[model samples]
Target: MQHPLAYRMRPRNLEEVVGQQHLVGPGKIIKRMVQARLLSSMILYGPPGTGKTSIASAIAGSTKYAFRQLNAATDSKKELQIVAEEAKMSGTVVLLLDEIHRLDKTKQDFLLPLLESGEIILIGATTENPYITINPAIRSRTQIFEVYPLTPHDIQTALLRALKDKERGLGNYQVHLTSEALELFTTATAGDLRSSLNGLELAVKSTPSDENQTINIDLKTAEESIQKKTLSADKNGDGHYDVISAFQKSIRGSDTDAALHYLARLLEAGDLKSIIRRLLVTAYEDIGLANPSVCQRTVAACQVADNVGLPEARIPLADVVIELCLSPKSNSGINAIDAALNDIRSGKSGQIPNSLKDTHYKGAQKLQRGQNYHYPHNYPNDWIAQQYLPNQLQGTQYYQPKTNGKYEQALKKTYDRLYQLQNKERGHHDD
Candidate 1:
């Protein structure tokens, strides 16, 4: 009762843990390890409140191993020595080392032997990337797994459980959470379950009970408790993907206003990398062939946006998004390339024509390579009727051009004329 709601609601076993299904789900690596009683040292890295600590605690709980906690930066060698001695006495102990990236060489050297002896199973946790921040010695000794932020659904599950659990949760108090209030708590804290639980506890404790003697947490109370942020969408949340999808679809559908609206949301979220990636993809896939130059300009705009960062970045991003929405749309380039790839993947290719084979070597002429090949530059218009495609795909066509814009229209004309000339030349040979 004295502990924080988050601490009280901590998963006592693996089954009680929320989120990180990839690591804790049935048949997953971690679960398999626990089932077989074969636990190894592992480093779990990801955003805060993503169940890194929960996973470690769950493993220790499930295996009935003694769990010890320590912070690599704050704790001294004496503390580690104490944990090591306990592991020796207990046979096996699960040690959770937080902020592992801050561990200096001195502490690392002391812990390495304990990890190897199988006496202390180290579970290192950090918000930084292990590959870049962690020492190779520690890294090589431990397995690495990335945990993800809790989705709104995952957070909701934990919140509901906390409310109903009479022992560890607020089941003793007759509390009613408005749906709006519940939603605010789940999303407002970005995916930090600890923060969400803390907010829920705050709302429950601060709000006065009504005449019914029941505590009612409304939307306003929830807002004050968690403080609805300017950026409503967490980069890891479903809302983030929704906005990005809307942004790309708006541009593709030629809705300038809608595209701009979604762009503003993403900018507010401060997700510059996602915005840039989506814009470039939209330019190439949606506006391609129709306006080749526009695609080039889009790349430049994305580069500028990346360089400038934020408020100023919004300027170039807005400019390109508007232009992309107003520009003519075509999928012909992507369509054509995919069509060629499909053919090649389906075993449509054949040997290169002898006349078209490379003539870089001395004996290539003896093999009739390039002997009969008509060089396009030697002919009018720098083009000629030649067998360029593999023999089996001699007349196969792939580049289906579009007439959505003047550029593609011109390309279609050129493609059709060349194909006709080549067909006509083949017809003469057939005769």
Candidate 2:
């Protein structure tokens, strides 16, 4: 039976695994667990083809335990029961449940007892975040480890190994791969070693051999095998959050290029809702008060994006993203509100001054409510200093505006002048 190149090239042991040194490297958590033969239930999660299944297989191989593989999406509850029964009979078994995030409550309930009894060392694999998708009972019983994407160098190493190994790889063929071809494979696969190896196999198998009986793979052959880069992003997975975080940070850092790059990625992935939400948050949190108009523009852009959708939607999104990236950054407004909130939460709220209280409804002027209230419009500069905040917080300043942008600079000047006049007025009254 001929297997796929990726399957044939699956790492048989820990030493053969190409990437994820953090888990499989010397003295690491997984390595120690394997060496000590002290395995437990765990979930391996990350973008696909980062060696999650390979790691589970390696652990079982090194420990010489009975290994069983099942897909949570297609496998029936009876199949899980069979595995659990076998674990009970054999003392212990290692079950590799792929797409474990899809495990239903029925199967989860059945496996919980076996997992608790220590008869089955469950090695669940998922591309989604376990915390988000998996049942709480199952998640609480397992430790989660993230498998990162393989680096280009790591993928190259795997490619070369597959080409050189005769038993499980293309070593039987006299193949010559040019550097350009190899670079294309690595670049097009986007750190997914499986895709890279699959493309390499296709190039070698599909290309014709020369008179010398040597299969020559050039850049054109590689391109034909894998035409486009496979983006390592899942809209419902951790990659979604990661890309959004990068996009926001880039805008906050005022890196227009990087911000645009991440925006293009999100657009390519068709993550419209996340993009819209993130743009609004960035406008307020990162660009607040620096250019207040940016927030209004961002909201308008979001509306346009929702109405127009896709291909054309990218325009308004790009406009807002670039505007935010280039705008002066400030968080003074958010900080000021947070400070006020903290004081309220800590019970620092004091009684409102009688002059500022509402006296519109049937007061009859008996309570003297709002009697001495000084309307700012009645004073010069449309500003008058009377007690507005609670008496306990009357003099405490919360909004300390930054002079990062021209708009904020004008505000700072006005704020300082108003307070200066208020202090003078109070001093005169005291005299």
Candidate 3:
């Protein structure tokens, strides 16, 4: 017996394939290719249940070309060779490779000679970003068609047809979908049509068959099946945005424990790489001179993530998040530099003072550029006050070191020495 879901709703033709109208609509690139019989190797990229399989099957059914299917998730290179042998004998072949991203680079490369020789036309399918997941050589030769999420109206129409279409649908059942209940289902499914239909099938199966024949589906039944009530602490979507906002606030407010808790929540939700990246940025931008070593450890965690790649990597990322949160916080350097840059972009372009500009070029000495530039190493204590910035901004201060770390402690003493030199120069001028 056929799977109930597959039996009831497989599209038999291009006209029957729903969504992705951009690719399949009249006179569109893919539609014209199908009609012209000039289709090239391509990859169908999208989330699951967005009709990648259905579109490939429709192409096979509608076109006269020989269609062969291989799943990269299960098939080995040997199995692929068998298909290639058959295709070589045949003049034309359409080889549909599903979950193609799961195949390792070597297995993916096995198709290069065949693709170049025109032994087979390839159609690859994947859910992940093909640029990151596919072999670069294989990717270069194929066209990429993007599938999109189905609209709620399209899903509702499909559900209505499933209820009444006699031969292949649930014609025997009298299913009543309340308006609010339908909206709830649409919202919960997140554009995955297969999950939506499967839930509808289950709801129909579970509803009692009786003389009253009134099947009521409310929000609760829909929620239970889809698990829509669970809250995610992820950072990509709305929940992530909210959670990260709270985490940043905790850090800014100096609540180490609260910041660490939110960081832990993000790590638990499989967002360690992203968490590590943020911590790296925060260490430099927020914890700068206050705790410079925090930046070093955060960068080390990023390297660790590249090395370990998973649940094992989560430990390093979590350690960095906690350490950065507890490290002393300061924004003096961040504020000062940003203020300077903002002035530059907003029509405050400052010229590089002649003293700071390199004077290695021929005849540079004739113009007196770099003529009086101080060599700090030649002076006692290896320090000198010089006009480094533009003449207009000569005395402007941009990097004010914080006092919470060892580097900052040494910086304060140097700053005091520099201040004394400036006052001494002023006193000599008055004399």
lDDT winner among the candidates? 1
The clash number for model 1 is 0
Off by over 4 Å in 2: 208-212, 227-232, 293-323, 343-370, 419-431
User: In model 1, what lDDT does residue 243 have?
Assistant: 78
lDDT of 2 by residue, 1-431 (tens): 88888888887778888889999999999999989988989999988778888888888888888889999999999999898888878778989999999998888888999999889999999988888889999999999999988888898898999999999999999999999998888767667787888888888999999999999999888988974654625787678788999999999999999999999889888889999999999899989888999999999999999999998999999999999999999998888899999999999999988888898889637988888999889978787776666767756777888988888889889878877776667667659
How well is each residue in 16-105 modelled by candidate 3, as lDDT tens digits? Answer: 777888988898877888899887788998766678877777776678667788899898899888888888787667788998878776
Report lDDT per candidate: 0.90, 0.88, 0.74
Give the per-residue lDDT of model 1 (tens digit) for 1-431.
Answer: 39989888988888999999899999999999999999999999977777888899999999999998999999999999999999988789999999999999999999999999999999999977788889999999999999877989999999999999999998888899999999999998768888899889998889889898899999999989885443335786544776799899999999999999999989888999999999999999999999999999999999999999988999988999999999999998888889889988998878888887889998887888887888789988898886778867767787888899999999999999989999889879769
Report the Cα lDDT for residue 176, model 3. Answer: 76
Q: lDDT of candidate 3 vs native?
A: 0.74
Candidates 2 and 3, the one with greater TM-score: 2
- Candidate 1, residue 326: CA error in Å? 8.6
Q: Using Cα atoms with residue i matched to residue i, what is each candidate's TM-score against the true structure?
A: 0.63, 0.86, 0.58
Clash tally, candidates in order: 0, 0, 2
Positional deviation of residue 271's Cα in model 3 after best superposition, in angstroms: 3.7
